[model samples]
Target: MTTTTQYPECCAKDNGDALGMNATATSPISVDGTPVAGELYTIPPRCGRAVKLKKGQVIKIINTPGSQVCDTWFFNSDDLSEFASMEHTRAFIDKIIPQPGDVLVTNQRRAIVTLLTDTSPGVHDTMIAACDLFRYSNMGITEYHDSCADNMRMALNAIGLRAREVPQPLNLWMNTPVNPDYTISWLPTVSAPGDYVEIRAERDCVAVMSACPQDIVPINGCSPKEIQFTVAG
Candidate 1:
């Protein structure tokens, strides 16, 4: 039998205390020229934020700088535990890489969001986990460096969630291609400046985004930078 649990309301229309942070006022704007419709938030490198998106509303993540990657995590506003599951989504969609019109499903197989649009030609990965301190330490850079896993934890905490509650995220603008020879390549992204992917909420959800801080690799255009967001009708 399928089971469902009750959770507190997590999203509201008001942006004043959306993520318990003054992101709208204090963050930098990453988009150039006149911006698009809806509220805009600038998520700086190594930083993260939680956004409240209502059902039917649209949220776009723009790669303001070329080849920069953003780690995106989604949670059902009502139940923080019910989040976007890449494994389940892939199993349901029967595809590793999602395209426009594909619906991202939750652990319960319920639709959470749909891919409304994509402007980037590069591929996005669903197999990788967000970078963490342990992962970095194994790579030999041990002093101390920011990571998407920590950033996501802080972002979710702003919304009253614990770090242990967060699950694997959808890594946007990431390029991890598999070869016929049964190998994979963690190559630099092909996405250019202003490229973006827009997704429509199938239900009320909270989104946590982190502009990757992996300077050890070329994931963020040889260095980390800021990213842009637009929530429109």
Candidate 2:
């Protein structure tokens, strides 16, 4: 006889739910997410976008306003289950925040993308999970609120794909520093306008980016803004 494990409803499924809409599901850059080389695309405030990149292709994400944080994730084009894993990346890089020249790994421990350039102070965060409805509810928000988690799901769906679960994202430009006491502090980004970071794909993959909609906190300067990116061969 084979044994089957039963899990709670909350742990059993990847719910395709969004509390509100920001056109994340309606607007996709392209039908198949293959972007025009060197064409800049905008991820509007509180929305998300997905792009497909071939091996060796590079994606340059820009902090147009210098205050917005972009929650980024990459999934193997061959298998959506093998997405970027922050925990695995931290172990692989031996650091909480990845710097230039660090190769980001997926859940399968395979190279997905390599950090090629970072023009900012290199203050990013990998310890925090993407914000979701539960987080907002805990913060006493009863109404609908845009969240990175939802943005990701909607983005992937817009591109005709879905993941089994939401993996920890590479929170680019997010400044949450750990203190000596083991506590963390959320602060606004120190990057200047137009500062950008470039990452090269190690394999064919789909990249998703969400302009974090966290307004209750100062991580996004309490006012979320748009972000830009371009894919280059």
lDDT, candidate 2, 1-233, per-residue tens: 33323222332455655545669999999987889999999999999999999999999999999999999999999999898899999999999899999999988899999999999999888989999877877777766688998899889888898877778899999999989999989999999999999999999999999999999989999999999999998
Q: Report residue 151 deviation for candidate 2 (angstroms).
A: 0.4
Which candidate number has the best lDDT? 2
CA deviation > 4 Å runs, candidate 1? 1-37
Model 2, position 47, has a per-residue lDDT of 94
RMSD of 1: 9.1
Mark the 10 consecutive residues where model 2 has the least summed lDDT. Answer: 2-11
Taking all chains together, each candidate's TM-score versus the true structure is 0.82, 0.93
Best by the TM-score measure: 2
Residue 43's C-alpha lDDT in candidate 1?
86
Which residue pairs clash in candidate 1? none
